[model samples]
Target: MFAMLRYAPLLAIPAFSSVAWAPPMIRMVLLMAVAWLTVIAAPSLTPMPYWSDGGGLLLACSSELLIGMTFGLAIMLPQAGIGMAASVADMQAGLSAASLLDPGGQHEPETLLGSLLLLAAVVLFFTLNLHVQLFHLMAESLRVLPLGAVGLRLDPEAFMAMVGSSFLLGLMVVAPLMIGLFAVDLAVAYATRSMPQANVYFLALPLKIAAALLLLAATLAYVPALIERVFQDALARLPSVFGA
Candidate 1:
């Protein structure tokens, strides 16, 4: 138990760097500590196995780690896809020129709008206590899908269906911004077509930026609701993802 507790911090390294307000090493250790506590307390709250001895223990631990990672990625994939899609849209909107290097990943040209949206999502997660809820859901997952049951039988069709649905959910979350941008684009195109010599290049740039900003501001009110729905759907489908 002591040894397992000591090793708990290793699991948190990934999460530490993704958020702000901590040095890499410290955050890593802190995150690991959190994971350790959760895992240690998990079996008591749920019907999970405590540590076992022998070679099979290694296999069990590895399988648990893998399952945890898979579930984490499953939750994160939609957010990553949305961020990428928003970045692409920002690029097309001429906002790529204002890109900044994201510290979370190497050589990634992060867009201002996308970053804002991502930050907003994170804030909403915490403000609504979704993070705690996620942790609780994860804890319950151990009961539903134990260590040895990590890579359980999953239907490929259902797995694919879930992935497809997740993508659509991500798209819907960003749909409002996309629609606003599309409308702006169409209006700009019509104006340019009507008057090609009106220096639309210079005029349209600021207009589009302003319009995008306005849309983002207006849509801000809906972000918490959208994020809640996305998270709820993701959590609901987690058991299916694990083949339970």
Candidate 2:
């Protein structure tokens, strides 16, 4: 419970285990279930000697907390790239000013395209059963980096590469939309140049929105592939978070 609570917000990025509006009891039940399942998977595992000492127990708890945070952040990076792409798309489409209904039932308004992308991404995530793979990774973490175990190993280069890839993901996903919108803006400028007295803002707004929607409609067929690639790459790198 403490471990998961440490990075619950990060986990929400991919909707791995977050049910933001669900009752607290349900959330606790879920954490309990996962814990139970982990133990069941490694029935021979036992508490570390640190459990008998207050200071060692604290250190163990801290390690568990760090473990959850590291994993949660690992999941968030690639998905956050998808989210960043949605924000960029909204801005390029001139839809940044429009608010979308909170599809997660948070009842808060978000960027229009962001909401759609997040909803679609979450649906695709579960459809691909990446959640199951992540669940398996969780179990693997226990065998590889059990609670309170000292002498943790890490690769700073791998983590830095993960960070760099996240930004790259955003760029790749939003590139098409950005290019289409730029062309639209250029054409709209040329068309309106002769009529400086005319209200070009009103005219160009609708054109940009239409072109944006059309471009997205045409290119959306590739989104699932993009998402799958991003997550698979992230998952492959995740083991480095807990080991060398």
Winner by TM-score: 2
Candidate no. 1 TM-score: 0.76
lDDT of 1 at 100: 55
lDDT of all predictions, in order shown? 0.64, 0.70
Give all TM-scores, in the order shown.
Answer: 0.76, 0.84
Candidate 1: count of backbone clashes, pairs at least 3 residues apart or interchain: 1
| Candidate 1, lDDT over the whole model | 0.64
**Clashes per model (N, Cα, C within 3 A):** 1, 0
The residue pairs found clashing in candidate 1 are 9-32
- Deviating ranges (above 4 Å) for candidate 1: 1-11, 15-21, 24-58, 100-106, 147-151, 154-158, 197-199
Please name the candidate that would achieve the greatest lDDT relative to the true structure. Answer: 2
lDDT of 2 by residue, 101-150 (tens): 33465655467777787777677767999878877886777667764565
Error (Å) of candidate 1 at residue 1 is 8.2
